[model samples]
Target: MPHLSLSDLTFTWPDGDPAFEGLDAVFGPGRTGLVGRNGAGKSTLLRLIAGDLTPDRGSVTVHGRLAYLRQDLTLDPNRTVDGVLGIDNQRKALHRIESGEGTEQDFADATGHWDVEERAVATLDRLGLAHVAPTPDALGRTVGTLSGGETMLLGLTAALLGDPEVLLLDEPTNNLDLSAKARLYAAVDQFPGIVVVVSHDRALLDRMDTIAELRRGELRMFGGNFAHYRETVEAEQEAGRAAVRDARADVRRQGRELVEAQTKIDRRLRYGKRMVAENRYPKIVGNERKSQAQASAGKLRGNHADKLDEARRTLTEAEELVRDDREIRIDLPDSVVHPGQQVVEVADLTLACGPTVSLAVTGPERIALVGRNGIGKTTLLRALTDMPPRVPWRALPQRLDVFDETRTLAQNLADAAPHATAEQIRGRLARFLFRGNDSDVLTSALSGGERLRAALAMILLAEPAPRLLMLDEPTNNLDLPSLQHLTEALAQFRGALIVASHDLPFLREIGATRWLELTDDGVREVDPR
Candidate 1:
């Protein structure tokens, strides 16, 4: 039976136009990709499928139990990975039994004769959490101490623990690092239930059995992976455009022929008139011939008009089809830079250690402080700005001026250069796409992409701009086009950049000479090229 089916579904958000209209699709016990451009209602569709939101019209039928993983999860600050995962001493005993370190009587004592503890440990191990770290009780830490990616994974583990019949994930790999993302994919691949993913990750989409593209409130199913869908869709659009061009050409040619025919008819009428004037008996015949010519000309004109209208309508339809099938646009901004190799020269820079740990960067280099979520990428950038030690970037005894994240565009400029006025800061902000009222918004409320842009705006626009610009996960929530623009801009930037990003494509585009791969094993520099 089908796992989840949406029949003639239609939905609209509170403010926007309808997102889906008469959309229909079906998922079986395998992986499927729900792909669309940014703001294409992929998230909303996932919610509907998960039964968190109901369609405004039509029916969403579920033949089996469904589980969903949202992009962001807010967990209590007091729970541990073990508590959240339902793993305890009992579970540990079961693990021992499964590993043959304990007997069946021990397992019975642990699970009250259920023997489900071993099964649970095996399941968790399969999800790639088989580390032999000390228990959280021993560490005296809660889930709140875990990294963002770890917390997100814990949520997924909870969802999977129920053993649902279907799994729905919405951009599950967004904030995860390479290793966590790999583990998530492995889990999805091994899952026994249907997997429906709403994601923009082309890599993940490669594993999908089918791709359902959402555009202009319509769903179009293709029988292959994302690459195949891309090829087929582009080909179809090209064929449509070609058809329109041919039809237009035919209409133009037919118009020219019709005009020529009319001209011939007019010439023949004149000749007949001349013949009538030469012989009075031929006058009546000439008049009849002229009338016949006029009738034929009128008929041709009417038929030509009809054909032209039909051709125009056909062209309109073809253009619409092409537009609907076209790829989404990503408008990437160019990161600006001035010549002079010394963008940032940090010598013995140490980070703060309250909410953030300390670190040192003592070189003029384009670097990346790569790590899992909440591992001080932001802290390092903040030290460059010298904000509150909530997450400070403590510079070690150096004449360092940081481009602060806590300060507004205007305020940051004033702080960076005390004499800089508000007007100058506003002008600079405008150049960075923070125009008019946008520059006034508080830094804390800004979205991830917006904050990154704003930070760049304030710094790059400043007089004697930062030689070393630091960015923290610059592409976290940015849509594709914006990312492309940033990529292009960074490619042109001559100054040093220290960016923390998991987006390999973006890193490559920005032309990082080397990458600082931060893992559980520690930080190591490698050539990512």
Candidate 2:
């Protein structure tokens, strides 16, 4: 049976435009892909279904227990990882073990009721954090000390604890490593509950049973994977185009006939006037013949006029079809420097901040930059991209890292090169999806994926396009199709791509020739094969 139903739903933000109205959807026990463009309300839908918010109209009904992994991290920082997971069962057992004040029935209820500890340990192990024990260790640690990526993983694990009938996961793999993404995929595949995931991960979408896309202000469901959904949408577009073309042809044909009939009627009327003006009493032949021709012409003209009007109306409808079916364009800038061969040359480069932190990346390579969290992957990218010194030291000149979250994308780039004028900066920003006021908005307001795109777009706009494209987590918040499109475009680009991402399938699909692996101490190149 289906686990959830959304019937005739309508919702909007306070003081903001309406998001969706008259929307109806149903989801059952299976992995479902939820996809949409930026600001299309994917997050809103998830929150509504999770019961965090109420819809202005319609109903959202859940038939069974539901668990949701929110985009924002929510966990008890004071508790240990195991303490968080073992909350329900461990408390019962520990209560019985700690206080001996209970009868046989109470002891049984507390002791053998549930194997909470075992379940907690298993869940932690599944999350690749099995080393964490239920009790405190030498390192005084709680969930608070864990990295954002680790916290996200643990929250997901906790959400998956009781095996509820439904699960709502929002970008669960956005902050994970390649191995962690695989773990998430495995967990979702084996889960018996209904799953609704809002993610931009293309590799993950390939595993779904259905694709639900929110566009403009409407939601559409397609029965298949991401690729299938696209194909179906395109097919519908083609059908709409065919209808428009047929309508146009009918209009043109009828219009020409109407013009020819009107000309014949005018000529016949003039001939009749000339005969009457001659005053030759040729009334019988001229009048009768003129009347017959006029009647014939009038009938033909009326028929053609009717067809013309009908055609005009059809043309108007066809135009509506054209406007409705056209796809929105994201206007990417053309690249400048087309290098012949060697784009970036990196030697035995070792980057380090302190004694406990260091990373390395060898040059003349197509490397996948990878690590767990709080590691120096992004730092290494900053060094490569030659971004401003947030630290005390100066970045390398040759390297260019594309992670500009400091200011408005344009302002940051303009600051990077003060010699450039506002007009030049505006031109550069336009290509990167930052046009006009978009260039003025603070970087903090931009979405993760949009920030990455803006940064890369600036790189592509560079006079001599950076030979070495050092991207720090480029696929973070991008939708599946956008990521795939980017991957395909990057494949065509003849440059050294040094990307720091945890998306394994994304890395593999992009054909990373090598990998620069980072640890707490330093970095090394590894062959995943």
Best by TM-score: 1
lDDT of 1 by residue, 1-529 (tens): 5478889998886645577888888877788888876556777788888878888899988877778887646668786555665555555676677688987666666755344444445554555544412332332246655555666676787678667888888777766778788888888888887888877677788888889887777878888888999899889889988988987887787778778877877787787777778885566777887788788878877887777778777778777767642222222223333443333333344543233233344333456556665554555565555632211121211111234556665676566556667887676666555677767655654433445455555445544444455666566544555567667776666455677777878887787765776544434677675
Pairs of residues at least 3 apart in sequence or in different chains that clash in candidate 2: 346-363, 384-399, 384-400, 385-399, 385-400, 385-401, 386-399
Flag regions of model 2 displaced more than 4 Å: 72-115, 132-140, 143-149, 266-366, 371-469, 488-497, 503-514, 519-522, 526-529
List the candidates' TM-scores in order. Answer: 0.73, 0.72
Report, for every candidate in turn, its global Cα lDDT versus the true structure.
0.64, 0.68
Q: Candidate 2 on 320-383: residue-level lDDT in tens?
A: 6553422112333333334344344334456553213233333334578777764656556655
CA shift at 26, candidate 2, in angstroms? 2.0
lDDT for 74 in candidate 1 is 63
- lDDT of prediction 1: 0.64
Report the number of backbone clashes for model 2: 7
437, model 1: CA deviation in Å?
A: 16
Which candidate should be chosen as best, given lDDT against the real structure? Answer: 2
